[model samples]
Target: MAQWNPSEEYIENTRLYKWMQKLGYSEYDLFHQQSINDVEWFWRRVEKELGIPWLNHYDRVLDVEKGIQWPKWYVNGKLNAYELALGQWAKDPIMTQKEALIWEGEDGEVRRYTFSSLATEVNKVAAGLKKLDVKRGDVVALYMPMIPETIMALMAVSKIGAIFTPVFSGYGQEAIATRIAASRAKLVITVDSSQRKGKEIMLKDELDKALLNCPEVESVVVVRRTKTKAVQLKEKHIAWEELLSHQPCLEIEPMNSDEPLMLLYTSGTTGKPKGTVHTHSGFPIKAGFDAGICMDLKRQDTLFWYTDMGWMMGPFLVYGGWVNGATIMLYEGSPDFPNADRLWQLIDRYHISHLGISPTLIRSLMRHGDNWLTQKLSSLRVIASTGEPWNDDAWYWLFEKVGKEKIPIFNYTGGTEIAGGILGNVLVRPIKVSMFNAALPGMSAYVADCWGNQMENQVGELVLTKPWVGMTNGFWEQPKRYLKTYWSRWPNMWIHGDWAITDEDGYWKITGRSDDIINVAGKRVGPSEVETILASHHYVHEAGAIGIPDHRKGDALICFAVLQESIEMTNTVKETLLDFLSVKLGKSLRPNDIHFISDLPKTKNGKVMRRLIKNAYLHLKLGDISSIENPNVLDEIAQLKRPGQKNL
Candidate 1:
């Protein structure tokens, strides 16, 4: 057992503890003791305490005879997420006219919608969808930017009990077509164009190209955004406003809790995206619970998360904030556009209370220095990070600059499958370097090695031992793939393919993906290990390392590095880095070669695309190059390849 106890000072000073006290818990000891000793009772109490409205009650709270295979939760219960998010709130006199969504575009355009107004818009869209012949279980593909209409469309689809599959606006036509076709979508909602970095992108044209390959799509609804010349509408194409002009704003169809709500795809090692299906009750409830208790969100709080509708974070952010009656802030542009301080300016202007971002963005801000971030972030109460593992330097910089080293940086980790974070850092926990203080309540997580044996203080695969409410039902149209990917490796555990370790302090640290682990001379070395070491170098701005097939060493560590402006790539510098690595991690773990480049390949959200780097090195045909932010970086790295060397 771990003797991990939070400091009294930290608990008393934290926003989470104060909220718990306001909720009637005088101390963390009482709350934790009650939570652990009676988990079912605690969850039941939470369901009631959080004011979750249910039309039908359950006979039993939990049924475990089926194990993870078919564990029934809230048996005999009937509650729809749509009702909990909009219906009850809309009925309440105090919350009816309150602002629920606040949206801002890249071109200084702003829009606000109240709870009642949002419900009206959602009902109109829902009626429009019904007129277009959409029915329960029918898939609706959303290929739009982060706009208010997108949120309305999501709620409209869920209200009518249809499954929504959102494709990122940054994705190319081919990627979009693949997802739409795979889901056999009956309709697609998009816009003529979208603004990003002060430029208008032709989104409808891209959708046109994608729809050519997706014949199952019966109709397309286009929203006017950039005031660009409209495309020639086909028999199936209709303007968004025209479609909903005469629709009523009071129609809503409730759904069962276990019905599919959304399908989010996760790119696998082979580049084939797996569609993860989340149920209505499983995801929305979990997201709201975590946002309310863990984030300590309030009605007056404004939550801003820089994300697209395609990512799981988008839905998580929407449900989490809306269910808590907090205002949701949506930004439709690049984070670094116009200036490096754009995000900061928005926070200051909007009085945002909670800010969620990735570590890569923070590191980029760190590269630009702290002059902009040093401004008064008085409205900011907490900072949250996800998507990729954060380095110590970035973590410290974020806590120092944005949070003043006093606020909690909730380092959370889960995936599209779980819908929300399985492990997270509560506000009362001590801040550490890239560590998750604890798993979410009712979740049981463990670290195990390759032999299925539990490990401690050693890196291993992260697994969930018990089934939770937020767990995905299965993959969309591919139940076998779901079983093979997560459940086949372990009898009853869900093995998330990531490398993690727990410290003696009971804090968990994630390295990189287990599939990305390098085998050098029969020894295992995670890419994060070498990348972390390389990031420690002052001259190295960013680095991504991968293992390539080597005739002599079996698999050798090949590193690609980006340099700072004042740093130059020279033979001496490379040797110095090699020597530094030798001194720090021993010569055996030293990188075989380090190639300096202008930038590392990344996704739009700033996650390093290491698979692309490995593919470039081996001269392999790059799959789904559409998701890369800088596809040219691969060609630039390819130019440095030696003659007759294998191309990744």
Candidate 2:
């Protein structure tokens, strides 16, 4: 059953419908087929429709001479991402004064920036970078929080044709040091301090510790976010105010379309984190297309996605909102801080229209009841979600209590490597609960087995047969490793490392990561299936399911459950859940054991790290846990293992 079906008025009013009409197509399937079959023509039309002001038009839309993995897009085109996203908007006399960016701090502080003012700040920072001898192609690390300066720094680097990589604010010394060293960054920008839930974090101190071993870093720029203490000026240090005090240079670098724009590093299950490279025209344009045409982020509308700069959604918010000329809203605080209503208050206060979040956040907020939903979210039109799979209970709660069953939830799924989404719920189609209505146009997405045979109605690896504009050129100077990670899985096919299933109705749902699937006896099942069943019970707040080594069954399902607040774990509750799972998932699929805990390990973005949970329980070596939000939970999970269980 569909949760949201577009009305006639809604369908006709969308940018997608308008674009389809321009292309003389009324049906989505035909348009999507044309998009993938003739991608060059489709992409050329996309840029023109988006009104991209190219300094020099490309002679060719795409050149696949180097093969699909290394296809050069927009051959010979000259444009800067900063220009498309901000400079052009500011040049418009009327839109110059409109709110381009709005920010709110946890301490009740608020700031607003107009297009013209933001451009000026960005130009000043660009000049400062030049003064510090940061040349084109230079890598600069942004170890700052989700503040206005972070956006300024991002645009500034792009304006000068330099690259910037954002580090998560919650990262410790080693994590920050690792990225800076890996990128060989020339300069680093950070905040003096930041506040989260009334606690001060010394961000500069962490950077200082990281810079100790990052020999390539020549300078540091510090923003006074909390103004906790005056930064001591060293040879390599400069104040944010000082950087802004420089003469504003209004020169926009005319960069080649394929020039490096940003290097976003994403952690893997094993080995080192991969540096996914995104080009100037690549990331911004794809992000704009997804936000504008797919999600309907119109001009003057406020777009807000709760995330940090380190995350992919962070850049998505900046470039996506800016390219569409929409107002981007940032909240530099915990989502549920002084009260559970903080996110709701922000939406109502800012009149945000397009809101993005994770299913984990919705699950967390459901614990507080409906009292926090006091604000009338009349301005909100759509809700978008990514990061992890959604459970039926949490999905229904958000759709009913928050949206009143009127607004649509656009389930988006992709990765940093793809720049934007491969599968999403476009407004043109009816949206099913917790599933994608369509694979995003221009992406040749399908579910297939290891050998590339297409499959339906069963779980299979999500693979892309052709390259799209936003596809990463390759990992930063590690072509062999990049090939081994994605392309090596099957010849020429990009294995996205996710397990997906499509129903006869054409709706798609991501089960879980391929590595997270558990095989018990001869049946393989995604952890989300079992977790969803566990979470459906009234006593269980959330759950993490993993497979432990079994002597006879090959793999036995083990579940760790977090109980609702004020609820105590008992044998009765455990038996009730286990029996309920057997009824829902069948006798063979039921969990072998269930343990109660206070919390599950998660990332700052609210994604539960099940790999860490399994490693902790098995007393195995946990690798690359820098993204973990609560490390202490691992210790708690480790203590729950029975005495007889050996390390797998």
> In terms of lDDT, which candidate is strongest?
2
Model 2 collision count: 0
Q: Which digits, one per residue and each the tens of the lDDT, describe model 2 over residues 149-219?
A: 99999999999999999987876665577678888899999999887988887888878877888999989
lDDT of 2 at 384: 95
Q: What lDDT does candidate 1 reach at residue 406?
A: 64
C-alpha lDDT of residue 438 in model 2: 92
lDDT of 2 at 187: 92
User: Which pairs of residues collide in model 1?
Assistant: 615-648, 616-648, 617-648, 618-647, 618-648, 619-647, 619-648, 620-648
Best by TM-score: 2
**Residues 61-81 of candidate 1: C-alpha lDDT, one tens digit per residue:** 667785674556677777777
TM-score of each: 0.78, 0.82
